[model samples]
Target: MWRNTELVRGLTLSLALLLAACAGAPQRSADPQQAESPRPAATQAAPPELPKSSSESPGAEPALAETPMHADGLEPSADTAANGSSPPMDFWAGLRSELQFTRCADEDTQSRHWTKRYAGYPQRFQQTIEQIAPLMQYVAAELRAADLPVDFVFLPIVESTYFPHRSRGERPAGIWQLMPQTARGYGAPMKPQYDGRLDYAQATHAAITLLTHLRVQFNDDWKLVNMAFNAGEYRVKNALKGSKGSRLPEPRGLSPITIEHYAKLRSLGCLIDQPERFNLQLPIIDDTRALASVELPEAWPIEFLAHLLVIDPQELKKLNPGLFGTHTPGFPGYRLMVPARAKDDLIAGLAPLPTAVSARWQRVALADPEQQRTLVLQSGLEWDLFTSINRQGGERVWLPTGTGVPKPVALSEPAGETYRVRQGDTLWHIAKRYRLRVQQLVDWNGLGKRALIKPGQWLRLRAPE
Candidate 1:
């Protein structure tokens, strides 16, 4: 007790000295009598103040506010809640909502390969979608119109990355990645002059048509249809033949490639369906910038038409990718794609455009051959434009836009009852033959606005006037 008392006394003295040192001694006057006067207790120093928080002042640095965690935390959302309608109906959401296979299967029981890691696939796909927004949105709208699963819209990601000009192994081309045979089967021409496989509108029609047919063949099994699309119907059938098919209700066959293909699709579908899982955000896209297809029979210069319509020629080419040159090769159903906004103005001012583009001009040599060919040229060149133009290889050929093109032409019309359609016959040719307007010919024939006249379809030469 005596030692404790001694320790407490020592601590007391030390603390008092420390306080005095911290408080600091006040200024000692030059005269000691002034310092002898007692300073008030309030004048003794207090503790230093702390810096102000950001919340208290505008100039202070701020800290992130923490979200308060409850005893019960937030939960993942259910697909269908009280209303049981659906998730959001946007493009990605629509695709996700249609997925029949949601539960991840055990590796031992399932054939799906989760091998392809999520390494930049989502980012690449989002970039590609942005690059081809108009075309993709158009495809999605068509799919919705057909009352089919919109999941097929993502097929182009697997096929060609939405690039219209992509080709593989010297044969397949376009956004759909259709082979020459498949393209022909769907009535898209793949000739040297004009490969219709690259045409966005036409290819979308063909893809949907092909999908419809595949759906029938595979009994509406989209997985099998997708496999058929990727590996061809023959291989898919063979795969189904060997194994009891599981992707569909009916027993289907499976192959390694087909399994891998579907696995890739499923993987791609997941990334698109839930991009947040991969830390990616997709751009909102629409095909609302409307494109109108204008059927013109003559070989018109793309540049001239673009200038007249006030559209960029490069952009116009994107809309009409089938035409493989500066000037359209006058196929029978040559549709020129123009901006829907400018369609009315172009139609109003089309007087500057030539009446005919194909087999409509004949070569005329002048004294000044280069300067005077356009002065006195002739229309009604032979129906066999390929041979006629090739024969005039050495002559200066005047174009519909009054420019000179130094190249040959393409295929001829067939002889049959009321003009059998040839490989490259445009409606203008048949109309001109019967001395009827192209619209009259189309009206009599019941052709769609953008429909192409195929090689063997007989066209009506004359109607009751």
Candidate 2:
């Protein structure tokens, strides 16, 4: 049985990786603090009371390490308490009351929705939860420190299902589901060298910043803040105008919005109205006393740390999904959150990031004359990997074997060329098809919005030069 389970797990990971490879990769945001000088690794010792793995079921609703609930808080009214006993109303009421709850500890009594929604595929959900629960603890601590509602930690679960590489409509990316504009607004640089949205630490800071801003804008209303996160501030503002005193939004605008937006906001409001539906509770996670930090050397890979520490790479990856790629990108250094007592040993065990620069036989080319640099193709390297690394430095560098870069294919003098936009086509796609970048596409077509391309539009591929 154990061997079978291990086989299943391996197959699952392999499938996930295969799917990822087939899908077009999304853009990532960069860490803001990465450009600063690297910081030395933390020298503190690990905490003595690190929670034992065997104590709690892996991926079970995260066991809160510390209670943040204060007794002075207002008690729920009889009406609220009465509602809490109802199946639909109970779970959410518990959340609103800031009490802790989970799926009925009895596996049999667990609601079908809860089982299907959260626990049906125990292996997959458990794996995701185990990886994400630690980070959730970190997020919860940060929010609680600010006196904000702790349920904000659930946003990532809904957004990415704890998958750091998940992407949605357009190029909105990362666990927090940030679009490029919003990511940039939250201080994420959308450049090749860095993408802050994928940097877990930086993105968490940005998520908190955005959440705080939304909370303030909504007058500390958690429900409205959640709505804002789902549908954008403008849509939420419109919804607020429509939902006067009722707990639910009228069924009117539901059609106009995307199902994801509609479903998420409705689910959020439902949780507000009747928390028991989701078996949610505000958890106690204030165990900062037992927390310690592990700092990484610049560009250190978590996989290497995992190998050095004799821990599973997946374990380290789960703990630090924000690292992105196989290694830390563009960041000068990063801090890893761990149980407080384990800090010293972790730091002591870490090996310095390798910097052996070998001039292996590789093809080279001049990509940009302005930078006075050329792209090199290292032998035996994957073409996509090579291109991705070079693109990180900006300007087209190298193409895969059998995909030679077309040398500035110039358009003939002043002829109107009609181009039909296909499905999944964007200005960026059109630019690439014409061996140009987004800027060139916009300039050629006189388009004001870089993201506004649609299927079937006839575009003039070339302008009078």
Candidate 3:
């Protein structure tokens, strides 16, 4: 919920206004052939909203269109294919084996610019690779799963330097640097408790879907799809229509920044393919070290789960960056990203939590005989007295004196001893497990209707002493 603060709202409003102003503002352009000026390195803040003339707004790029997957999915070239039928042992090796667009001509100025950036500082370059090894593995796996060209794996370096939590002050956020509008358009949940864009799994899936849609829209031209991603889809479409032949014209109606983005992806792909040419060694990303997604049976507080898994909560938080608070949201069937090494521990840790069973509660009011008959008919209660009692806010009833009273009955008397609350326990969960109503748990434990339970606390399963 912290991600949805007033500050984020205010910043979002300001961004909307800024885009509106930039749309009508005149922009300067030069020949695309000349050397385009580079922004600060990928490590710095960037990809600001540039002015649009014929071009579409940067962060306001349209949501992913519902383009069907091509008849034949994009495939890796022979050179990029892994040896034999066995899976590649290394994550980076698997990606490299599937690369289809790592080549750039020797004389291409755009690609050359990034070649220098990669070669400028050998140490920093290697450090960057090491830092993003796990993230890269995840992206690579997702692309492979979707049968997308592995070349797209480098797009994040151009967008967010593979930092999941990176934000441009309410501009595109997440590893994919997805605009809020685009993220929402794709239906990647963006609740107060969770920003799906910041979640690696959610962000990667949404971006890949967009990329796939673009590939189909542009007739499988990866280059044009990359441009569409940076510039708006309509801008690229217009450029294609305006050009003389099938191929986009030089510049392709792209501004300097969009061109740079295209170059960055091509350059990064090329450099990874031939790092030896620049006297650089690419780091091996261990498949064992990558984060793995585990679908949680129920919501769990991060701190308590971390303790059970013998991991630091912050480290766990890094893997699932979207959650805004101590606990994951109560969305059913939520998936959590945890350390690959700790998957077994996580399963074991969750084994102790009570499995939920189906239960339903009916509301009824206490009233005098004649009123009760009318109430029974209206509310579907039998003639029998309710087994347990609790108050639901302001429902009409009648007292012996014929004075109007308001109360509700909770079914089933509480009957168990206190159970020590576990990490993922909720009142709804505990009540369902014991076949007791949630309201009864609240009344028995003296907990407020909205009280949140914590691990290690004692909760009364039956009526409290």
For model 2, residues 1-465, the per-residue Cα lDDT tens digits are 000000001111110000010112233223321111111100111112221221222123321111111011011233533443334332234344542222233123223333334322333322233334445556666677766766666566545433344233335555565655666666544443235565455566667777887888787766556556644655455555644565344323521222232233233333333433444432222233233345553444444445344456654544443433445443333455444545665565433212322112112355465333223333344544454344434443422222221222122222225455544345543442243456766777787863477756777765645
Error of 1 at 65 (Å): 39
In angstroms, the error of model 3 at 94 is 2.7
**Ten consecutive residues with minimal summed lDDT in candidate 2?**
1-10
Model 3 RMSD vs true structure: 19.1
Candidate 3 regions off by >4 Å?
1-89, 104-107, 165-170, 243-251, 332-334, 344-465
Best by lDDT: 3
Better of 1 and 2 by lDDT: 1
| Per-residue accuracy of model 3 over 283-399 as CA lDDT, tens digit each | 544445566666664555565566556677756666676776656654544567776778887786556433331011223364555765675455343343221111122354311
Q: Give residue 33's error in model 3 in angstroms.
A: 29
Would you list the rank order by TM-score, best first? Answer: 3, 1, 2
Ranking by lDDT: 3, 1, 2
Give the distance in Å from residue 224's predicted Cα in candidate 1 to where it truly belongs.
1.2
